[model samples]
Target chain A: MSTQIEQQETETEADEETEPEVESPGERRRAQRDERQAIEEAQRETEEASLDDENTITLKVFRYDPEVEGKQEPRFDDFRVPFHKGMTVLDALIYARDHYDSSLTFRHSCRQAVCGSDALFVNGKQRLGCKTQMSELDDPVRIEPLPHQEVVKDLVVDMEHFYDQMEAVEPYFDADETPDDKLEEQRQTRENREKVKMSTRCIWCGACMSSCNIAAGDNEYLGPAAINKAYRFAMDEREGENRKQERLRIIEQEHGVWRCQTQFSCTEVCPKDIPLTEHIQELKREAVKNNLKFW
Target chain B: MAQHYSSFDRGGRRWLFQRLTAVFLIGVLAFHFMLLHFVNHAADLTFLGTQARMSQVSYFATMWLFLVTATFHGVNGVYNALVNQGLTGSRKNAVKYLLGIAGLLLVVQGTRVSLAMTTLV
Candidate 1:
């Protein structure tokens, strides 16, 4: 495969140790690996030495790789990154990867908070890595993948479960009826739009779900983000009353809004400042009111 | 999804009842504590003194309601906590019935004790 060739190329170029023509291919490969190990040891020493320097910031990053023999066990790798005025946590991670170790892996895009690809556990809090500044954190910023999710590799977690929960809520808006004319428009009042405004801003970053205690324990719980997603559609007046009732039914299931303890953990960690707990409470009230009407 | 049509299966009723009972208990619990501990000194109270208080129709009803609400709130809270801790399958059903029976017995025995204290029964 082409990937095999690329792997070989990187392996050979990893270290600049002079190779003698007399050695076998196996021997050359071993020598190259040894040189790479020696480089890692030297880098770690420099990483330790820079801790005393005033200009550099220490980053304790969680590292793991199931496929790599030595890295199979989870551990924290320290990187010494030069501090800058407006440098964010993502910038520091990028600098560490580019300058010190190319294998330091993390997901990042857009360099802004909109992409929602860089949610990380920074300093014992869930935060957007690109939005969190290094100056605001303590000396050694501890960065790890979000908790309550299986880590796929270094700084990347399995988001499949989060996606599954989101899907279970039937997040798409479904109107009960549409106008006969194709050109006709479905309009929403300013009040209705304003009501669901904050709930619509969710970026599916998984930070709220990761921060939720109920979602962590009850695996079947729909979670804050998914419930908020339901809130957005369920509150929209454009979706007819029939659809709203249907949406309410979905969220009112045994593991739905009832599982929420109103801890506000999701609201506190939301990057978009969505009032998650308040929305969940409102849904609970709505479900009860609907039931009372039937009774 | 067809099963979700009924309001009872949605869990909203119990959730609402829990909050309602919590509000009621908050007020009643303070009164119970104050009456027993502050207003009527526990050391000075005897069996006849308690019977005299329980013999009053209004007092008997209040105490009975207090006992029933406390038992429901305490047992329901415990069940919710265990459910939230990922209890499921047959174990969840076992806990549900166990708590239900325990709550029922508590209410029954509490009524009998309250009736024994009252001269009206």
Candidate 2:
């Protein structure tokens, strides 16, 4: 694609040389720039015209702004984007922003699933926009901010609450004691790492929390990502037994893992393919066993 | 966040009991249905036949235990559902006590009715 654009730029430069020179040097340069812009405009128009319904995809994006007078009321805007084989929902959104409405707004960073910044409600499901292929979705795709979260603007939802829940679990690993030697490493067994491996894959995309029905209804529920974070540290062998017990108590609280209905919505929407519900269940079982030991 | 120090308030005990009762209910429910609908047949049910079944100490004890567990399971499920719906504060306490009283009344009435069916009572 970069090569194609470069070829077009060179061709436009060659065409500029053929024009008769009458104006001053600076004026000529300005005239040449204007002509090149007009040519680019015409090329774009023709390219768009040729990109019939078959070659273009339609995106209906949610628009909202509490501060903008005309845009205060939420609405959906449609943009026609030229489609390519590997184009994703995020690609279409970028095209719409660049070529159509510069005011179009959304959150995205790496343009990959790793950033976990582009989670959106696409076609009635929680998904990462950068990870969802345009071809996999139906045409006239609908995109909105993740549900159960307060919309900040356009496709951006307030993620402060989600971050709070994640922090509530104290996601960082705290070991009981360090090795006597400064250079000694606190290594984990292969089996122990494997046990907590899936739980450690949370990208904090907030998709699982948005997809959970119970989380939607219960404002106090810790939700799946937080429980998975707790699971990650609680199951780690290096963490002290006291730390593990504290983590278990946190998850076993009234609004913690017990609130999960095992609906599998979190697991289904997770971009990392983390078995979230299973981890929550494991935590519940661990909590129960700890209590039984006392009994 | 509410700090839970005791096992009673941690929510784990009720969660475990709910699962335990659910497992017990599944088996006992199947047996109850099979006994009533398949073996005895609804058309063949009579007061005397019910009395004869209730007269056996083993069967009577099982039925009573089933009633108690079923009440706890059903009531606890409803309570949990309410809590998950963001029920809180005094309203949540009200619902908790109301549901508890209702469950107790149900078990007591159930036991009395079962005793009325048995000659030993």
Candidate 3:
């Protein structure tokens, strides 16, 4: 009899808790319609805003930050940016950084292609961000850091090694003698300057180095950029025969021009369109020709 | 930049040799292939036919040169490939010695085989 009385008490408590609070169906429908209308109106406003200025472009940007807890895991963030005629990938990145996420990190100084600071893997090809047109790329353009490079952050690679390799070639012009007259410059023939004109256009972008399979495999290999740097001075008649011979000796090391397998990847990806393979091949021939003279 | 101590320290000699041997091999290999497969039927080969070609001093000398060049080219190509893959230090030395031995053995054994074929005449 005590157990039965406890069960009755529990039932009475359950009934009190289950009491209904009701609304009319018409009122609920009107509220739902209002919410839908508000969402549509907002969508319309966004579309009008987009139409007011320009068409929208989708950019899938690679993101990673070891310091931030949320960004520790690498992910791609999509940003819908306004597209203008002749707009470049760098411009889109800037727009996204300024309007969407201020924390987006990338290295770009001069908007012009001269800086070589913005070499990126866009659409599976190495290209300068400031030079690649948005219209030329397919929709939802994929942009990532250069391949075969250690990414310090989003779209930024550690260029220390590349700079080191370039320096290893002693890229500056070294001459044994100054002009006899203080006011006069060292003379170079028109043909010689034209020969090295493309080679001299290297902005130290590291694009050709990054694109080289040999450079990726052999750390010691003087990459196309560095070898081309050597070529610039080695071929210049103004540097004299001794300096040219020294330059050739430096590049003819085991890890120098011989390491190049004629992959043409460096030439293919060079932003300046420098003929890296041709230069390397020419150096090989020159080295061979010089060695034959000794025999 | 590091200075090469000896006249041979620069890789120019080896690189030039590789190219020169490549050009020679291309011509010799093509000639050998055309002679064996196209000019003469490969299926009709006999011991006497082989001895007949080996008995000629020019043919025998060319075959000897071919054997030497082929060994050097193949061994050097492998060494270059290994170096390109970042082989260095003791590991590179090991590959160097091993390839050298292999090439020497190949040339020695190849010469013995060539002599045996000629002696049968």
Task: Tell me the deviation in Å of residue A214 in model 1.
Answer: 1.1
Query: TM-score of the second chain in each model?
Result: 0.90, 0.91, 0.89
* lDDT values for all models: 0.88, 0.91, 0.85
In terms of lDDT, which candidate is stronger, 1 or 2? 2
Best by TM-score: 2
Off by over 4 Å in 1: A1-52, B1-8
Query: TM-score of model 2 relative to the true fold?
Result: 0.91
- For model 3 the TM-score comes to 0.83
- TM-scores of the models, in the given order? 0.86, 0.91, 0.83
Q: What is the two-chain DockQ of model 3? A: 0.32
Interface RMSD of each: 4.1, 2.8, 3.0
Candidate 2 on B13-112: residue-level lDDT in tens? 9999999999999999999999999999999999999999999999999999999999999999999999999998899999999999999999999999
Model 3 residue A270 CA deviation (Å) reads: 1.3
Q: What tens digits encode model 1's per-residue C-alpha lDDT throughout B1-121?
A: 2222234257787788888889989998999889989999988888898899999999898889889888988998899898788887799999999999999999999999998888978
Q: Tell me the tens digit of each residue's lDDT in model 2 across A42-161.
A: 767778778889989999999999999989999999999999999999999998997889889999999989889999999999999999999999988999999999999999999998
Q: How big is the RMSD of model 2? A: 3.8
Off by over 4 Å in 3: A1-54, B1-8
Chain B fold agreement for model 2, TM-score:
0.91
Query: In lDDT terms, how accurate is model 3?
Result: 0.85
lDDT of 1 by residue, A1-295 (tens): 6535755665667644445456788887787778666666665566556655687899999999998999999999999888879999999999899778899989999888898899999999999999899999998999999999999899999999898888877888778988898679888899999999999889889999999888888887889999999999999988999999989988998888999999999999999999999999999999989889999
Output the number of the DockQ-best candidate: 2
